[model samples]
Target: MQMMMAGARTRTTTTMMTTTTTTMMMLRRVWIPVLILMMFGITGGEERTWNTEPAYETQGVNVTVIEGKSAILPCSVHDPTSADNKPVKVVWTDQWSTILTFQDNTIIDDERIHVDHAFAREWNLRINRVKYGDQGIYTCQVNTEPVISYTVHLTVVVAPRLSNDGTGGMLEVMEGSKAELVCNATGIPAPTITWFRKTADMGERRESEFCTGTSIVRRYSSFSQRIGEAGQVLVIHNVTRFCGGIYECVAENGVPPSVRREIQVKVKFMPKISLPSKRISTQKFY
Candidate 1:
């Protein structure tokens, strides 16, 4: 009986030892996996949030202008080829002018301005004879996922410019009778003509600059004639005393403000007069 009891006790002790060893083995496996997971987490570092501000490829453009001269508002752009998933929308605006809109190729025209060509994605705006009032902040808005904008400030400088052809008369005219004033100009974009005359009050008056004579100053005949392949001729016919004055011929090339040329007209006649009135006074008395 004593031996059987001692055998039972021994088996119970062995069973308890086995159970403890199994629990310790299971804990060792769990610890290895937990340590690996913690190490990976430590090396991974923290995640960063996305930036909310809009991305810009470049800064604004710079524009220069001459007062009393025409200019083109220029804006530089970069093609975002990668982010081309969305179409680009460009909007240009000036403080004193209405909003100008542009897309891939088409341009919109309004009463204030006109687009020379739209389809080529040329967003250049032509400002006729830049005045001080025309200078302002021009903004270029490009739309994609986030909107990108560029601002260009136009600086206008006051400078003398030729606004018209110096010639008031046609290319040819009668010799002794009368010759009209004639003038012409060449420039970029194009220019307008305003005749000026020396007045008693002001050295030059824009309104009365054309005529102070008996000869009729007909309507200004304007026609555009093609010169060479790249040249052009502008003609105005039937010039007279009224057509004579400080003629302002302005030429603008879209970049540099308008340029001008000043011309003086002087009519010459024969030394001899054929009329009988001068000799008749001597002969008629008889």
Candidate 2:
């Protein structure tokens, strides 16, 4: 009886040890795989979230700027190229030579031109004090295996200029004789000239004498061919004392302000001789 009882206790002890070892092995199998899967999920999420790739985009076709001012040439990209996540290199050139260079997100030694980038996408160039020499085709190139580029045409507009030989002022004409006043102005757009007279109240008085008015008949003669532009002309067929005043020649070409000049006309006639009345030299001298 004592031997049998001892054998039963030994079997129970062995069974308990075997059960504990099996539970430990099963726990390791479940938790170890779970930890590994969690680590992989986290790593994959990071990789997908932080994807830095190069993309290409177009900004514009052309840009216009005024002379003595600034100009901005725009460029863009869908993805920025990089070697080791470094900023993509950018270069700006014209038909002649290179104007700027942007490498590692910084400008090079060029001072007249620079980059104006924002939102990590915009790649625009700023040209300070634009000149006529700056007008041309500009290209923006990216340093890529198969280099991507965009071309933009730049136009520089110069302000309108005007010049004249300083004529048409204070014209003196004899009565019954023809009078002609000429106005000449030079500009980029070939300025248009109009003639008018000044009134006593500082108002414009324009009529048959205008440069663009119809022909006026005077004493059976037509002055049609007399009034035209070859430098603009204002002709008076039969000059008289009433036909003299201050004439203004206004020249304009869509510039900010128009240019004008004033001319005075004086009609001369034969002087009439008048006899002085000798009214009794009042008082003495008799």
Candidate 3:
């Protein structure tokens, strides 16, 4: 009877032990996955902290442009670190920018703004058209822990135009009045100037304005002549009634269109009276 009782007690203890082990195993299985999921969720939620590295400190760059032309500015980083590795927000400013920001850019409003991918590490500023006032210092700033800034100088050069240099005015002189016909032209290539005169012959004049003649003293008759000279200047020493006509100055650079100026000369003098003034006074009353 004792042995049976002891055997029953042992089975009861074994069953209790088995039950406890099963319960522990079930608890571990259920808690292990739950603990792991919770840990993962907590870690992931904390991972994405709004963080960015400081901008790599650098200096401004230099650029050049011609009047009515284009220009570009480049900004780069040096001695990069985690503080300087993240994408940077860049701002560009110009000392002489009329529009304020270039197109698409906040600095000014025009169609000339251009930004590239490398801007994350290096900033590039591009202008479609540059003007005289556009030449000056430009600044680039990166927003970060320790904001980095850069500067660049821009030079704008304009080529002289024919409109301003090739233009001239007319020269007015009275007929029989001693005068000179001058044609002045200014250009880069030193434009070739020509002067001519239109006579009844319809041919170029044999004598240029510089030639000396007695026509200044003689009574001038009816003669309409067009005087034209081809040179930098055409000078007529003594002008007469015959010389009073259309004077044209032509400037040619072998280009499609040449510049020309026309001057009209009108001769005026007191008409001679048939009867002398002294004879009329001496006759007195008839």
Candidate 4:
């Protein structure tokens, strides 16, 4: 009985030793990597350094400005890692080439182009004296890990302007012939041309007239008549003496300050002679 009890005690001691050895090996396996990471200055209590990339806070926008005026394109970014005091690189480009670039107090040398950075996150591009050619898509880019960009569409408005060459002047036509009067205009949105005719006394009259051969319809008002055809050319078929008058052409668009031009049409015909006493003329010859 004493021998059996001693053998049971020895087995219990062996079991405890094996359990301790297995525990120790498992702890070493778990702590080895942690110790190596600590040696390289990595710790769970430290603040994380990796951050998400910079992103645009606002979507792309459309900007409209009148010609010869200043235009502003807006761009804003939200950078999570900006607090680390790292340099942020910004670039502005168009369809053709790079307009400007900025990084660490560096900027493009352009008098007409300006970068407004009054707000830390806002980067607004300003262009002075914008022309028609400046109207297009402008892109703002940030130099990030993969790079991010925002696009802005610019529209330039131009007022209507009438051309003088072959557009307006004295137009002469023979009686019973066709006459064409042209009014040329140039503008950004393609100005609409309208023709008007003024009467002799400039009095108010209500009448509706229509012409053949291209079909010009005119609605007469008190002072002037609005030609039915809304085109650059005014067509008059079978022109007579009544067709000779002062015609005005107006070019207008949504833009302000419309333009107008006046043209005088002269219809020429042979003079007709009238004799009251046709029989008396024959007795005088005898």
Each prediction's TM-score versus the true structure: 0.31, 0.52, 0.39, 0.66
Ranking by lDDT: 4, 2, 3, 1
- Per-residue CA lDDT of candidate 4, range 15-116, in tens? 999999999988876665455334323355554333566788889999999899999988887872443667455667786644453422223456778778
TM-score of 1: 0.31
Residue pairs clashing in model 4 are 204-222
Residues 1-286, candidate 2, lDDT per residue (tens digit)?
A: 9999999999999999999999998887666545533432332343322244456577558787767789988888766746467566566667774435443232335466777877576678788898878889888876554456788899876554444546546788898889888776754355778666554431222433432333332322212112343356777777766567666677776644567777888879888799998876557664
Name the better of 1 and 4 by lDDT: 4
Runs of candidate 2 with Cα error greater than 4 angstroms are: 1-56, 103-111, 167-286
Better of 1 and 3 by lDDT: 3
| lDDT tens per residue, model 1, 1-286 | 9999999999999999999999998886666444533432322446322233224444566677666666666544455322423334455666643355444322334444544434333456566767777677877665433345677788775543443443443234333344444334433334444333323333333333343422222223522111111112322334443343333233445545545444444433336657655543455653
In candidate 1, stretches whose alpha carbon ends up further than 4 angstroms from where it belongs are 1-58, 80-86, 96-98, 104-122, 160-286
The lDDT values for all models are 0.47, 0.64, 0.54, 0.73
Q: Considering TM-score, which of the candidate structures 2 and 4 is the better prediction for this target?
A: 4
- Rank by TM-score (best first): 4, 2, 3, 1
- Model 1, global lDDT: 0.47
Once fitted onto the true fold, the runs of candidate 3 whose alpha carbons sit more than 4 angstroms away are: 1-62, 79-84, 96-107, 117-121, 144-146, 162-286
RMSD (Cα, Å) for all candidates, in order, is 28.6, 26.5, 27.1, 23.1
